[model samples]
Target: MSRGKTASALDLPRPDTLDAGKQQGAYEALRGAILNRQLPAGSRLPSTRSLAERWLVSRGTLEAAFDRLHSEGYVQRVAGSGTRVCAVIPEQFIAAPLAREIPRRPVAPDQPDAGVQSHVPFVARRPDASLFDLKTWARCISRGLLTVGPGVLEAAHPAGLPELRAQIADYLRSYRGMQCEADEVIVTTGIRHALDLIARSVLKPGDTACVEDPGYLPARRLFALAGAHIHAIPVTADGLDTAQLPEAARLAYVTPAHQAPLGMTLSVSRRLALLDWAARADAWVVEDDYDSEYNYNTAPLAALKSLDSGDRVIYCGSFNKNLFPGLRVGFMVVPNVLRRSMLRTLQLTGHSVGASDQLGLVEFLRSGAFVRHLRASRQAYQARRDALLECLGGHCTVSGQQAGLHFVLWLPPGVEEGDFCSRAAAVGLTLQPLGKFCHALALPPAVIIGYTALTLAQIRFHGRALAQLL
Candidate 1:
């Protein structure tokens, strides 16, 4: 019995006049007919023998053309049903309308800085990839593959794999001093993913979201996209100024462990004050604990979530910076009240990270390789930071060097920030101006210099070059 409606005869061009070979010509004709809608989806073509005889081509040639079409998803072949045009064409072959321009949202100024190549010296937030123990990670991945069973292959929980979430919660409890269980932890692609979930779950259009001024611009832009009115609150050396927090804010996004670009630890008093404010105002606090593992001068502070007696803070952290950016595994610990909403948001959005990678991370953490890596990375980054500081001594003032991967280099009085960055660029140096992180708050002239990704020699060379420029 015919499985699909038979297609009408196609007036395909002869292979003899068209391009190189008979098989190629046959494939092109069929593909063109399908795309042009002459041969609509679910319509079966004539048997290979009949089509070959009709086109005056060998049966083998016609079969080969059908094989190509099937491989490329243009057609589907069944044992008794024969070849039918696919229900959907590949997206690339679908011609988009030329008449209308796709609407686009305006990109925020703080969207990833342009022209900063990862290989260039002083590129911020990048880890030293060379230091990663690839062999160990490979072994972990192998073990993870062996553990995959029928359960692992099934539709994963939108919150993530339970084993991986448990591992992350344990790690955070031990290192970040947060009291959390596996159920409280939701696996995400990274901090951005976590923030996106938080914004969607909690915010209504026009709700006020307070973000740190001279802060992480991506966070501000994301909240704005969620239809929240962004209120840029000033950030002092002590971190976000709690005194200026909006009375009606629905959420406050902060980088408390190590402030983004500025690298200040949120003071204990301010952390308490911020939490207090959130409790009173019924607002949520998002703590992006990015790069808190690399502190050199002092012991890493407890995560802001640890101090949340009111359970108002949503703590976020990512392995992307500590391991490698490509890892793309992060987790968030939300309050019990918000978990249902967060999970609902995830279910609606169909957010699921790769199970294999999550399992591999579970192995990585269980084997204690992650802790060993962090210890080694901390020492290496500290050494590189010291080397760069030594080379820049007496040339300029530097701050925010006690922790994190980057520090702020203040321009000498009367030295314009733009001119300094332009001069650096002329010499093939990439410098991120402090002005780029600022919105409403005006800061002194400076540039953010990253050291973790650079080797001691690169740091010394670039540090000297920057000094000479000064």
Candidate 2:
């Protein structure tokens, strides 16, 4: 276990830990050293001769460990230089550990394959920033600074700026088909902030909260953190199965516009049924309108909030995707009766949105620039979606293609999502598994392909490589 004078700073496996067998023991030790930064990235490894001598093993044994690390991308070998830690560690290596695994369940999509990383092509759901017109946006910011009154300098409403709220209310009415007033719109950061506020204000510890199975993972984790008993409702093609809802559930989170991971719009009948169920169960519905702006094949459906005759819906919307993600601005329309309580809650918690950003966003929406940006981004996204579907559909079963930035591609037979993703990573493809979205229940093996951030050329190029893998 002691370090030899000639050995590199990289921690070698203790001889006792080698009971598992030399290669595995060496691999685990070296991997841990890289991950924990004991062997900082790009640090050169000790000469194989020196390391072998220190470990009291043959040079071939150390080389075997080095070969494994090189193949898995933990380290690289230069033409003249010896092996060194990879300069950019892969994403899979850094993916947050699974918080909890439901016992006896199969491998889920979305789990990061340890040691897999960014030599893989772009696979994340982040919006493409290339299309954003920095010039126009800067002008909008300048306009906001010039036109926004001195009143904006004062301590603002915790909910958000009045002007921005009014603009959002109008935008929702026109685009999302929701009826609401400025007062009902409580602007927060993004979906996370909106949900945090809702969870804090409404969910009591141990209260049952219904979440869509194979749904947004972060939302489920948030609910768990708030001490709600998560009731995972299965998502069918129609959306969250209303018939499967638990009666005791007091809060339900849904992505009705385009279901997360699965692209199906919540059917009108199912939306109404969900609303009715919420009313009957006395539950509040948190409708996450995350990516409602990019409907391609059909006219966008009315939001679930639009059908809330009982005022049971808390409508959430975000500009991060459609505008720019860094904007960190989104709004929620609560029932008039709930507005005061929500505002009070925000004030108490001090979850304030930046006033300058709010003012700039107000100008962006008011100046018609936001709409123009949406129209352009929508067209570009639709093209990318079509290109990706065209590239991938023949090789695999693709679903949820009607809208949204991403869709599900069912894994080929006998290839589980996790294994497929791991294999994909090795060949420079980053794959998101559908399994990671599941909680207590299981879904068919699939991978989510995000088209928005990638170009048509990149999609076609990577798509062919992926098809060969399948």
Candidate 3:
């Protein structure tokens, strides 16, 4: 306290008087000011003499501080610009180090029907459109249009059409091993919308959650935006490694049924172990049963929700794999207790599934069209998965091939995921590096290729191309 006068912040003494501490403190203060946009990108710093005078520091000390900033690329010495801030920083600028930064959860965005074809020559994700029975689908849509009396195209019932819910419930029971009532099914636009709703409703700012590293980036972004602290767990060949689980997280989001980018089922033992962990940790598990319909071999593992003794699992699935991605129809099976709140959320968000589309889906399911579609897509996707594996030969081993639309090619030790992806794209085929999915760890290098949209022929073509490229 300076007598009766309020102490001015700028006039405060240099508390970090030690040489090393003072230099580090100066760097941090200036960096914060620049990052917060207080100092615009091109702004110049005060002269050494001026800064020394203002901060009551020796000229040599001020010069040393400036030199540190310059070496760190935070400031530049231009011919006439007088040491202005760098116009662009490096990619690693301000990026938190793996051990120092809080882990971020990765979440995929809600995909719009319009953008499904945005990246043309798109060879990502599951779907054999050429093999799809478009005539059958057209017939169904036409029948629905003819059957509608009036206002069928109007706004929908907020809770969704009862018929569609019943259909989805039956399908889940028969295929997904879900023991849920129709009333508990809430059809969402996709997983993105469902995740956002769940985060907004169930999680509060600063609540901790766990996500798979080298997992879905969209989930990570969503959880981070909601202000939750994310714990990044690694996904292995048999889904996420629960042994490395972080204890403090209150919730976890996973794609256990079929790990994304690297298609692998959660082993039965790991499934139970993960559920047990959740029970012990008192955390909620959001099981994204992604690409469940596109399994390669015979009977896959049962849904994680199938083993939920506690009302802790929130299950989500989409027809993006089984049917066309443009369908944009995914269902979230909530626990009975959360059903009403979930429905109310859908209503409040005005994201009620379309009545006509839902009715059409009802017709499709009851007529067994959906199952037929699933079976057909399964056979086609399984073929592509095989082709890609066959193409890999002995270059690099593939991971997560028992089920799901895509798999990862764990590259040679020297090859970084980013460099491989960039170099491959330079040669014409777009590939996603596995490292992009990592949140807070030094991710292993691997290329994740999706075989869903590509045909067996395209897979072979790219396989040879990739062989040469790799």
Candidate 4:
């Protein structure tokens, strides 16, 4: 055949020079053809004898080229089927190099920034790790390890361990006034994980979800990820404005016991109104009782679930705040209507809290040690809160100090929220602006200050410094 005819049939150039290592040249020619799709996927190559004669190279060189292609996953070879290009090329699936202008989804303006775990003063929602009772927790962990047997060797219950569930049930009944059994409790990594599971189980694309205007930012993002149309309802001094709840919403998320950034409890009337709205709208309510364990003046109020006569509430709480953040154990007291669906979701997703951690929590709840620890934590936090309050001494307005780990400091008329936080950071003081938590509703300038992670001395010093800055 003529040179042009041979090249056309093979769709590859002939090896330039046999003395320059014909095997390498042949390999390059075939590889280039495959990469450029001149030799399409699954197309058979010519027999080694015929191809060698056509290219004027020895058959051994052609075989060596084929062998290299096969080894690199560029082609497939079978004794009876001959050699063919691979159906899927290995090089085609490699990720492209990073570019400055790659597309990205918009992040929530209120999303927490990096270095959340850093020990910065006045950083909200952080607990004091130094207060954790390590020796007692270590003993409980050892006891928990013994509880694991051959039954859990294959798989753990998707919902959670039975013993841990029962202990959690008892604790909720006594402490939070929630009426739930072991079967109704679904263990999770934390509040965020619980919300994710609930969102997956119930929310459908384009469904409507009502969230507080200055709400938990993560929950809003989760619902949005599920493709729900988020409706930010205004929060008044009483809590979420119940009258503004949409009639067509499929879910309503609230931090009723203590509003997140605002720190106001939902009044009893509004609580009933919310349950009534859920029932009327045929929607599910997610109650995030994130940090109700440390009410300063009065006893912590009963959870919204306790008032959920219509069975519309899904109560979520986490040990991350009460015990330690690293524990990563949380639970949801779901309504009976959602028990099966939540369990099925858990099973399909294959997510379960660590069995050892669950069992250790069970031990912690059983030994009366958890209660003692809470007592100590409350006393320490209360002292810090008082010290900080005394230091501020009418320097600026403070609210939400009645409960939870953080309180809001309302900025004076001339102070800008962003500028105040920036000034605070310049002095090595970390702060969270209240505007960060707002979605659609505009509010007066303010900052959320956390005291639980700081000692009394630190709180006094920082509080005085904040007053001076103000």
Q: Against the true structure, whose TM-score is highest? A: 1
Model 2 Cα lDDT, one tens digit per residue, 1-470: 32322446665645555576877777777777788887888898886787777777778887898899999899997655778899877756678667798588686779764421222354646567778888877887778877866777785687787888899999888987888889889988889988988888888899999999889978888888889998999999788898998778988999998998788888899888888888889989999999888888888888888889999999988888777667788889998777887888888888777877887788888888888988898898888777766766575788887788878888767878878888888987887788888887677788877778777788789877877787
What candidate 4 gets wrong by more than 4 Å, as runs, is 1-115, 147-150, 153-155
Ranking by lDDT: 4, 1, 2, 3
How far residue 56's Cα lies from its native spot in candidate 1, in Å, is 28
In model 1, how large is the Cα lDDT of residue 346?
A: 86
- Pitting candidate 1 against candidate 4, the one with the higher TM-score is 1
How accurate locally is residue 201 in candidate 2, as Cα lDDT from 0 to 100? Answer: 83
lDDT of each residue in 1-470, candidate 4, tens digit only: 43222222454447575558788888988888898898999888877777877788888988899999999999998876678889988886895646687788898787556544425688846678788899999899788787666466466588888888899999999999988899989898899999998899899999999999998999999999999999999999999999999899999999998898799999989999999999999999999999888899999889999988888999999999888878899999988889899988888877778767877788899998898988999888889888988988876799999988889989999889889988998887888889999999999999888889887778878888888888
lDDT of 3 by residue, 145-239 (tens): 67765666674656566677788888888887878878878888888988987887777899998898778888988888889988888877677
Q: Rank candidates by TM-score, best first.
A: 1, 4, 2, 3
- Those runs of model 1 whose alpha carbons end farther than 4 Å from true positions after fitting are 1-117
Specify the highest-lDDT model's number. Answer: 4
> What lDDT does the true structure give each of the candidates?
0.86, 0.81, 0.74, 0.86
lDDT of 4: 0.86
Instruction: List the candidates' TM-scores in order.
Output: 0.77, 0.73, 0.71, 0.75
Q: On residues 298-399, what C-alpha lDDT tens digit does candidate 1 reach at each position?
A: 798899999988899999899988988788889899899999999999888876688878888989999999999999999999999999899988667888
